[model samples]
Target: MSATRSALPRQALVFLAFGLVQLALDTAIYVGLTAAGLPVATGNVAGRIAGACLGFWLNGRYTFAEGGKTRLQRRHLLRFILAWCALTVMSTYLLASIVTGTSLQISWFAKPLVEAVMAAIGFVVWRQWVYR
Candidate 1:
């Protein structure tokens, strides 16, 4: 029982570590595209797509791999794509709203904040549904 309890936190820690990397990649792409005068929605979608690809592989192989082995099956990828699509829509909408309601300068900071919130929700969904 104790081992099982510990496993959740340990897994969450690993997930968070990988999430940080994904966030950096996502943010960099978003900033670059937005700075180039691309629409916030376009930039957000592009960044999220890139991040999701890396995140799916990283989280699967390291954070949620069964028996400490990297074994990503087709179903996992399918589920991840579905979940990623939903999350991307939500994040892009939120980011775009922030940009319209505020300013691009503010949206630059808001991007990470929005993604951090999404990441929190993502961790649970990925653990319970996507990876499982």
Candidate 2:
């Protein structure tokens, strides 16, 4: 039990590290595309796709890394993608509801709250199945 508890914080730290990288890349791509005259929608989609790709590789290589070698095996990658997609879909609905059914303070709280829940879910899936 203690080990599991310890692992959770470690996992979260690693996850957040990769998440910051993803956010940086995503923001950079979005800003660059918009500056180059692309529509905001196009820039947003392109940035997200780029960020997702980066997140997968970074998390595989670093976040959930085990042993000494890289954890970029194809099976793990596929499972991670499937899990991430499912969680992302879930996040969309939850975020939409939060935005629609809440006051300003609550709505403002939606993103980090949703992201935290999604991160916890992702960590469990990754630790137990994706990278196991």
Candidate 3:
């Protein structure tokens, strides 16, 4: 049990890797959609939903390792949803404000950066409040 506990940090690294993969996938999808002339907001929302689902799956399966729980499981799922929603709104606003307010023509690239930050925030919140 002690050794198992000690392995958590390593497992966390794996979780982060999985998260990054999902993030990359989400970004690619969003960019592809936008390049295809889809509405930005539509692409954003669709990417968010897909990324949130993938995050939940990976975190539940690999990060927390509590996917089998019943009652507690439901609560974690709910918390994940709420947390994702909050982070999404914050990231979206931040990206939009930075892009429009700043003279940087590359502001569109800020979306993935914001998402990464929000994902880190969500991981901390989930670990402290939702998982344990």
Residue 57, candidate 3: alpha-carbon lDDT: 76
**Which residue runs of candidate 3 sit more than 4 Å off their true CA positions?**
1-8, 66-72, 102-105
Query: Which tens-of-lDDT digit does each residue in 16-125 have in candidate 2?
Result: 88877776676676557756777544554565577778877887787777555567899998898888778766765664466468732353345455656776787788
Each prediction's TM-score versus the true structure: 0.94, 0.65, 0.79
Ranking by lDDT: 1, 3, 2
Model 3: lowest-lDDT 10 consecutive positions:
63-72
Which candidate do you rate higher for TM-score, 1 or 2? 1
Candidate 2: Cα lDDT at 130: 86
What is the C-alpha lDDT profile of model 3 across 11-58, one tens digit per residue? Answer: 579768877887787777767776787755666667788887887877
Error of 2 at 61 (Å): 0.8
Candidate 2, position 1, lDDT? 81
| Candidate 1, 1-132: lDDT as tens digits | 775455688789998898899899999999999999999888899999998989988888988876777737899999988888888989988988898899988989988899999999899889888888
Worst 10 residues of 2 by lDDT: 103-112
Error of 2 at 16 (Å): 2.5
